[model samples]
Target: MDMGRYLFRQVRGSDAAAIYELAVANEYHSDNLPLNRSLIKAYVQRSVKDFAIISSSGVCKNPLYMFVLEDTYTRTVVGVSQIKNILWRLLYQLRLDPFLGENIGKLALKKEDGTWELGGLLLSKEVRGGKLGKLLSYGRLAYLMSKGLAPRMLISGFLKNTFWEYIAIRIGVSKEYNPDKHWRSFKTLTKFMGLLPAHILLAETGIAFGYFEDLFKIPIPIKPESEPARKLLVDMGLCFLKEIEANGILWHGAPWKVIRDDNFMRYKVPQDTIEVDTCKTSCHLDIGMAVLPSDDFRAQYIPVAKLEDGRVYISKKDFSCGKPKHLFIFETKNV
Candidate 1:
């Protein structure tokens, strides 16, 4: 999607310095994406290698991508988003639902194949509005589609709040500010917690003290500030699964096709690509994005020539890698 003065693309090696500057200047720094220069460089290097491997072989063991939203004219990196593949065992759990009664369901990992996590999504305070957040968040998905590597499930986790802080202390694992370590402990706690069979008798007492163990992955309360993020995911076709996989974090997931279809209803894509000699027509406000095919994975919001014969046309010069075949053109909206 076009932000007019901004451009979004995968992280390049030269972006490490700017990324570090952006991270340090931001008031709220995420542990998953630290404010260290060396770390930022490592992330950029890894993303470049990962992109190359995926482009050539069409698969990778560590399928990770780091994307940046840059100020086009200024050439400054103002925002960043990361995508990585992760695996979790599809375990079962018993939940005591107030209205639904006791129900046994698979822990909310969503799919047996694996899951793709959207994390480390951060934007500068100055550029927070006008659907830029949605651009950074959903651009990761667009990148996945460009590579034809959409996972079976997609997820994002929030930070732990005070309510969870108290519960964590009682559970013997104090709230760790680091999200990575906190999530690791949460996973370990769920394993043996399921063995205890006294949930029914100890339910009320557990609630009174705020240390109720469900003998499974405990559901963490969604913090107030994270509500908007959660709502966006829900709007994108994800549901709040009962199984909380991390501390103070609410996890949401659904089949990839569900999200793809939901987004399709909003961001309609052109069925085919039309290469033209020159982009001689006015800009199409409704058309917002053009994505190259798998061999040359790139997405940008460039001017498109007016529709002719019911086909969307773009100039050959729109892409730097020469003429692309079957590029996906997405319609633009507030979403």
Candidate 2:
């Protein structure tokens, strides 16, 4: 989809080079977006295949969609957004009462239908402002709801390194935290524990666990880079699920129905042309993303739209090529 000087489309194999460059440039802050060339290429290939399969059969064993935003002026990719099946894992959160040192409870991972994760949003520093980031982020949901691929539940992870920071403090070292430090400490701690008898070790489990009891007490510093993404997730209706925390980062989750209702997920095809209002005047016009339902999906910003008879009316110029089967319509805030 064309957004003036920018374009949004599904990732193609040809975009591997541009995406690799984008990843390398943002390596310092890269979350899910990898910096490896081969890994990025494989992701592009899988994304292309997954999109094709889902468009055709409406099913894929491992679904993953990677969307790219390109600068039309330079014909180079500038931003990326990703959607993938949620990775389910079984793990326990070791907690101890700060005062009494008692175990709270262990949690087992559960699976649910229609669950997906929205993350891996990265943009070039040059195109960091404006609504470009929102377009790349929300446009993925627009496409999913348009194609009936919307997840029943959506999850998002923020503050990538905050988990490691928590671990650093638990190890009694903050600034000097690394793999070497962790490995050395792990060896020393295990060897010391090995010397204790089974009964003694079992009895001291509470004391051993108490070392990390300060997990929740410490204030986590939110990274400046992840603040915007977190805000977008909150705006999308996701809330913190206190039960889950991976790598020190708390995951946010919400039902798809909640997001759908909050975003006004009513969709329709434009029967006739309507004037595209830029909302520059005092008059108010709702902004949303218009997605073309086709094998080659394309989505762009729609500044003004009229919802009537459960059908959306948009500017004829937006669909100059031909009439589309469906247009994904959603209400957006602050553009």
Best by TM-score: 2
lDDT of 1 by residue, 121-197 (tens): 88888887555676677778777776778787887765544534555555565633434444446455454334324
Candidate 2, position 255, lDDT = 88
Tell me how far candidate 1 lies from the true structure as C-alpha RMSD in angstroms: 6.8
Q: Clashes in model 2: which pairs?
A: 163-247
**Candidate 1 wrong stretches, greater than 4 Å:** 36-38, 89-94, 97-112, 161-163, 166-225, 271-287, 292-296, 302-335
Per-residue CA lDDT of model 2 for 1-335, tens digit only, reads 23546767899989988888887787633335656678788888999999888777668866889999978688899998898886563223334556765544244445546778887788888777667788888778777766777677888765335445555555555656543233225443333323322210001221111112333444344566666777777777887654423333446789888887665354333446433433332232455455655567666664444545443344444444344444544453333
Clashing pairs in 1: 194-215
TM-score of each predicted structure versus truth: 0.68, 0.71
